[model samples]
Target: MAAAAAMHISTEFINLKPNIWKKPDRASGSCCLGSDDISRKRKLPILLFDVMDTIVRDPFYHDVPAFFGMPMKELLECKHPMAWIEFEKGLIDEEELARKFFIDGRDFDLEGLKDCMRSGYSYLDGMQELLHTLAADDFEIHAFTNYPIWYNIIEDKLKLSAYLSWTFCSCISGKRKPDPDFYLEVVGHLGVEPCDCIFIDDRPTNVKCAIEIGMGGLCFQNAESLAKDLSHLGIDLSVPNI
Candidate 1:
């Protein structure tokens, strides 16, 4: 029954989807398609980057477990699975997450967790430089991520907006990746065909979903591999010598 309902939802979403490829006026604060408009002319893809683990280092796998004084295996076993997902979806608040974080409902230090996550929020190796190159070359970039409002913590720490707009966060958009609706929403909002965008993510599932929707996708293993993949698409990512 749940699967059938999800299918119905997906069907409705697709049926109602808008064509978002119209050119925008300059007043909307979007990067205008200027007189040269190569991104439009060549259909050079706007890069959509997944934030956690792709661009920013996610602490959940290492720091959080360490903070809890347990191995990742034990932390996964003890945690309430849906609590984190629900938090990412913006269906619950930090307070609710703290209350229900453990399967046994044991209270833990929420502030400490936040601190650990914050301390670990550095950009992954070479990702920052890659982003700078993309932005410098005027390839439009937007963060397409499934994270909660705590994304502000990352913003405050790393200033990622210097490279990509925090455009399609799940907390703001009410959708998570691997859900077709989320990818479709990005397409609809960007005023571009699915083919005009490429999504990069650390997770194969998320990349697959983007590809399934007719968007190009690259499974991001590391920054060097990513630059090579983008180069293969005929998008120039030649890093200028500093």
Candidate 2:
């Protein structure tokens, strides 16, 4: 596992298949770095960003309920509680989700729901430009989101890899944020200390967990506020001109 992880970092382009099949081992202090690699690791802090409400406009709250013609509370009562979590953890696929979406197993318009979700997937204000700026500065960035396989839909519409790789998504990693092991595994795979990373999420609990593990964390309110926070942490957000 360590060798595979090392090979992944050694490569010029990231291969998602290897990572999907063989995720990193649990972090026991460290895993993949050699002495030579350690010297080359330090530069800009690596950014791990949450998707959904942090970077993209999640439709679950408003658009989903609207599509179902119900309020959020009513939808919650009708939905299967663990089904979504299972999907995020990659334990289930879309077909399974559609089958088990409602608590009573009552069928709804699955395709219509998916279409609604896809249509509502868009970048939040200022995020696109902010991501571009971070990319321009050569800061390493990866999506550290707790989303399901439907993240591909987001990628298809937005092409988020233009700014950051969809690297640490729960669907691929089989782990979610606030799970300490997930964060540790990410650190292990990156071969970096917790202090070397900054995790950004809209959820305070998620950010809290990352900070508790020694990574710099910010509960994102907006891109402007996030930029200010990053600057305060001594991050260089200035984009270099071509």
Candidate 3:
């Protein structure tokens, strides 16, 4: 009961089962297909992808709670003691993060806790082919993620930086998404207009925010829908010929 009460639904802790969005019905919130013009030219200018749930399967929301022998619904509540948003902003390190990974901080195994947090990540199905095809077609693929430094492990493990020419992560940028400044800075650094970029994330709020900024954005659900969305944008990605 305590755990259930603690895990109230909010934007801060997304990826809750049936859909990741706070407003799943309005996927790609208030979408304007300005980039559909590119389908005519059969060209893609740039691609910006979110890391969690977009590129990789999101395990953090579930695995951590399970580690503590609780239901996944209790993740946010369980994580309340942890300064996760600050961690995402690179304002704190793993040591600081690990310190907060407990409802009661007695006998906390820091190394073991760190290992649990770092391990057990996997890719979203069909993402490999999507990235492969886009990279093959010479898309200026980049990752615009709001994640902590620990995500570096995922990137290195999967060679994400190799697939995407650039990795614009929050830990590196010292900012988190939905802040709008993060978007402005990333686009400014790339020397591209927001409309020139295509951003993808599993969260509708993030997608909506991106669209509001004049970029072509898709609220990602799964790889199939993602492929279909790109297809509409003139970039058809089939199952990779690999």
Candidate 4:
């Protein structure tokens, strides 16, 4: 498994299969990460938790669309199509992201936008306790999410690094979720087989990718639902108030 070492987020790029979401045929094999290179040893499964809606709700999802003077649906449908993914992949900085997003003549305040992205993150009640309990039980946990440069704000504000062995973001890895390379790289870095991991993400698509790679996956509805799924997976989580 990957050590709980100093967080080293690299900019290196390694290409793998592209993730096309429409009707994906699940790969049937040992792993999307070649089994020949993987260790045959069985290992305890690590929990890979997603951020944003999975842990911290994104304020920008609604606020940014409103700031652009459009409804959320319209904004998502016609807004800067590739900017968010590009931003998440670290291809462009925040200023560039804002510039790209506000291209439709909407006035953009960089600081105000930063505030929208940074503040009022409400962690699902008992989430911290669940993480602590999992840690106490000697379960390995890591933060895996698709977030942009401002991910640092939420990471610091929520103090996630204190609980997780490693926190990986698209901005840091330059590889977004649902991409096979992202999951493969994480497993490769940890020196573990894909089967030795269970992923929790808010999106079904993200979970699907992990499943295709032979990792157990759970779509997170809430912390309570997560507790139930973990219990089903034979992980005894003792989180009160959940």
lDDT by residue for model 3 (67-170), tens:
66777655554554436666777888878766665555434566664566567567788888888878888778888887777776786667777678546888
Candidate 3: lDDT over CA atoms? 0.68
Ranking by lDDT: 1, 2, 4, 3
Off by over 4 Å in 1: 1-43, 240-242
Error of 1 at 232 (Å): 0.8
Cα lDDT, all candidates: 0.77, 0.77, 0.68, 0.70
Off by over 4 Å in 3: 1-44, 73-75, 103-107
Q: TM-score winner between 2 and 3, please give it.
A: 2
Which residue pairs clash within candidate 4?
Answer: none
Write one digit per residue (lDDT tens) for candidate 1, span 1-242.
01111222233333222223233443564534343453446445688999988998888777887999998778777888678778888999999999988999998999999999999899888888889988988778999998988999999999999998999998888778789999989988877667778788876767778877877878777788777777777675865331
Steric clash pairs (candidate 1) = 20-191
* Tens-digit lDDT string for candidate 2 (32-74): 2445455365444788999988899988877988998998778
lDDT of prediction 1: 0.77
* Model 3 Cα shift for residue 92 (angstroms): 0.9
lDDT of candidate 4 over 1-242, digit per residue (tens):
00101113332312222222221112554333345333233225777899777877777666666655777666665556677778888999878876776437455787876776666566877777788788787677888888777777876788877678546778889998788999999888877667768888866767778978877888777788778778777786878987
Model 1 residue 54 lDDT score: 91
Ranking by TM-score: 2, 1, 4, 3
Q: How well does each candidate superpose onto the true structure, as a TM-score? A: 0.81, 0.83, 0.77, 0.78
